[model samples]
Structures are given as structure tokens and as C-alpha cells.
Target: MKTIFSSLFLAAGANAIITRWAPCCFHLSASGAVTGTVGQLDDGQNRVNGPLSPAEYCIADGAITDANGRGCILTPPTSQWQCDTGATPTSGFSVACDGTVAYNGGTTFYECQTGDNGEANIYLTPGGTNCGEITLKADGCGSCPPPPPPPPTTCPTNLNGNYEFPHLIIPIDSSNPNSAAGTSYFGEVSSTISSIFNFDIPASDSGKTCSLIFLFPLQSQLTTSSFTFSGNGAIDFSLLSGVATVSTSYANAPSVETDYGSITVAPGNSYNVATFACPAGEAVSFELKAVGDTCLNYFQDYNPSPIGVYITTC
Candidate 1:
């Protein structure tokens, strides 16, 4: 037998009841033959006390049609309908029940209280159909965002900042470029070509603890594993500017060159050679000088550059 159920909520005097209606027309014969018609009511299953009077009525199609046939639905005026529990289910939404419906299905849902009890008998409706009415609201029920990720317990090794390529690379006077065309050669390739890197720090990372990282990839021959030409024992970091020519000697270097200190770099792929406190919103120049006389070069290929420097802040 085929069956359809209809539910309705009713309140009378000081009582509430769940009235369920099942069409009486759906019944199967002993031989398994389908019988009865749609909308037919079985009195035992459909009868319920009417909210209006003392008489009972049959529920059908979610409404009362007559007392014997079916009872008529009582439509109350504004402020006329009163809750038997003395308190309405917030009229629109219940915050305590907001996420309960979302656990079942749908991206959004509306929740409402069923009685003046604890957080029990919560009603859930999916989508925006019942919004702003007596039992649902447009803004009262919205899925809240998940809590943010927890902060890292330990300080990170690398900080976030803006880094740019150096505007100029000046080698010491009398030192010619290495076999690589535009690269600045350092150390005694023939006579000695000590290079100075002048990096332009962006003003965005100002007023923060900053550090400089130098990258030297082995594939680009930026670093020579051979100790003979890997003579970079220590590096000097300074704030330099007014570099008009590549032949500008360090002895007569610009007054803008404020030497930070000499720092040593370990033999590795990258080097965190210097750390400094960033100044105000001004483009500061970072100058680097290798101390030892080893034949090394800062590979200068813009396309997948091999050697570069990064300025980061924390």
C-alpha cells in the first residue's frame, strides 16, 4: 500500500499535540492487489481534537476541512495566537540551534525552538524559504566561519618582506668581469676582483627587523666547491650609495656607506650573511663585500638567475 504523511502542530488551552494524517485510500488486498483512492481518510488515523472547539475533526492535506469529514483550520488574527508554553520559539530563529541543521544537509539552515524548555526539540529548515516569518529569519541564522588557525608557538626562521634585485653590482678597481658576461667576479681570478653588491631595500619593510639572504646555486657555478677559488671566509655589510662608476674604490667610498659589520657565511646553497634594523620609509642601499680572495662570481642571468639576495623582515 502507498502512504503519504502530513504533519501539523496545534495548541489548545494549555496543551500541544502532534497531529499526523495518512490518506485512507492506500490499502493492499490479501492477494497483493492495490486498492483505495487518494485523499480517502481512515477516521481512526486522521481524527484529532480541534483547537477551536470541544469536537474532534479529521486532518487532511495539512488542514481541517470539516469536523466529521475534516476540521477547518483556525486562522488567528495578529497577536491572537498565543503559545501554550508561555513563550514562543523566538518568533524567527534560535541561535543555540543554528549549526544543528547544517550537520545534516544544505549549506545554510534556519533553526527555531519548539517549546519553553531547554535546548531540546529544535526545529531545522533548510534554505531561505522561511526567512523573516514567524519561525525563520533572513539574518538570524547564518553559518558562522570556522575558528582561525592557531598561532605558531615558535618564531619562524624566515620572515615575510619585499625584496628586489640590486640596482648596481660594483667590482673593485682593476678587476675584470669573469668568463660569464655580466656577472661580477670576486677574489683573485687573475689579479683580484672583489665585488660589491648594492641592494635597494623597499620602503615597505621599514621599521622592522630585517635580514639579508644570499642565494648561490651550484648549477650556475655561483659557488666553487674547490677550496682554492672558494676564498669567501667573511663578508662585510654596509649601507652604500652615490656609486657613479664601477672603478670607485672602497677607500674613497661614499659617506652613505655605513658599515654594519663583518659576518661569516657557511659553505652552503644560501647564506644569511647580515641582519639589521630597518630604517624609516627610505630606499636604503645594502652593500656586500667578500673578505677572502677566492675566484667566485655572482651569476647574473635574469632568466632563472642563479645568484640573488633577499631582504626579509619580521
Candidate 2:
């Protein structure tokens, strides 16, 4: 054993070249675990690196007390290394990294950085630090808490506006008089139904009578489902294109517009708009039903009249 150690010392001093000066070998100290880069003497070779801690003689000091030691000195690893003390789950025990830089309670995974080409790797103790959970990359970020829940959903706003329907003919059913039904008699005034509001022409009838043109004042609203509407309409008792001219005072009411009709979603949900058409040879068909609140109110007063302009168009 003495001869072997002597040969180790001789080999380390061979680099000195001048005098037979060998560094003073470490006198085995009592401190069991000395910290810092105090080179380890192991595996049959004399070693020294950036002065792996030498209480007596550092390699920087030019000569050791006993020519370094009889073993290879481990230099801190060459590859860049990092530690990731994985996030400890909220309810579980802390999963930490060990003194060797490996993580606890998980697989030993070490990810390589952007091109770890031509580099040496050692995980034990890179840079003389037990960086647990080693990564070939410098960034040591690890698993994080789960992402926060998504924000709650919210209802969207609707567009409030008006819908205009131009030139629509609405026909009112003339047979259903409120109280007094109409009969064709020479003296008995025929049932006279009148829409006071004039649309461009006046039905100059001696008594208030019905006309063809209609004006629909509509309102629209949006709902959670889709869309809805409400409207009140008046048929113009003015110069209906083909109707006979009657010079009547009721047809001359300044504001002859009557709230006689409404537009609402029909029972089948398809009645979105109130429609009108003057089909050839057929009396203008206009759906002047007492549909909504306003329409029902107006029809109440304008009912059971002595004159029924028996036109099924509102």
C-alpha cells in the first residue's frame, strides 16, 4: 500500500519538473462531511481541480502538501444542469428533489435544451451543488397549479329598432258587426266601416266607409330566444283605387288613422309580418284581425255601426 501511494504521489509531482516537491497529502480530518469542492480522492488516481477544497494547499497555490491525493478528482459536471422541485399538490406531501438533483415521487426525467450537442452530462452534483431534478436546460420551471376555471357565460345585448313595411293591404271581415248587422236597403244607411287616417287619398263618401291603403306602425324587440314584434295599424279610408267615391264627413276626419290592427307572432310562430295583396278579381285580402291590446281597444269603439263597408280588408 505504501509503494502504491508513493507511486501516485510521484506521478502527480512529475509535472513539477524541477525539485522533488509534492503537495502535503491531506491528513485525514475528523469532519465526516466537509462541504464545498474539496476534491474527492477515489478510484486509484491522484486528482485536483479548481482546488476542490484543500484546507492545507489549493492547486492554485502551485503545490500540494502530498501531491494531491491518490484518486481521480471529480470536477463539477460540464453540462448545464437545473433543478425543479415539482409543485407539491395542494393536498399531498411535498415532492421535493434529493441531494443528487433527482426529483422525489416521480420518474427521473431530464429534458435537453435547444441543442445539447457535444456536451458532457453528469447529474450527481453539477457545479458542486446537489441540484435535484436536473434538466439539461437552464430554465428550471416545473409543473404548476391547474389553470383557473374559465369565466362565467353572460347574456348578450339586443338591437332595439323599428321595422318598416310599405304599401301593405290589410282586409277586415265586414260581416261580423259589433251590434247592428248590415242589410242592403235603399234608406237604411249601409254598414259604414271607416279608417279615419288617409293614406294619400280620401274616400269622399257621405258616410264613413272603408278604403284599401293601410299604414303599419311597427315596433320590434329582441328576446333570449330570438326576436319578437308589436304593432298597430290603420287602413286608409281615402281614395281606394277601384272603390266608388262617396263624399262622406266621417271619411274626412282630419286624423282618420284608426288603431284597427296589430302585427304579432302568430300561433304557428310564422306570422311575423302583417301582409296584404290586391289579387286580380279578388277583393284586397288584408289580415285585420283584432290581434293585440291596442287593436282590440280601438275595435271596441269602432263597432256595431249603421254603415258596414263590407270589405274583408283591414
Which one is best on TM-score?
1
lDDT per model, in order? 0.36, 0.23
List, residue by residue over 72-101, the lDDT tens digit for candidate 2: 122224322221122111110111111111
lDDT per residue for candidate 1 within 1-314, as digits (tens), equals 11112233232222111223552111111100111111112321211111212223222222323234433221131111111211211121112123111111222322222222211111123222222212211122224556677543222223233445555565554443332223243322213444555555566756566666665544535333222335554666666665424545545445445677766554446666556775535455555555665344444432333355555555
- Candidate 1, superposed: residue stretches over 4 Å from native: 1-161, 174-192, 220-229, 241-252, 255-260, 264-267, 301-306
Q: Judge candidate 1 against the unseen true structure and give its global Cα lDDT, from 0 to 1.
A: 0.36
Worst 10 residues of 2 by lDDT: 87-96
Q: What TM-score would candidate 2 get against the native?
A: 0.14
Question: Candidate 2 at residue 201, lDDT?
Answer: 21
User: What is the clash count of model 2?
Assistant: 47
Judging by lDDT against the true structure, name the best candidate.
1
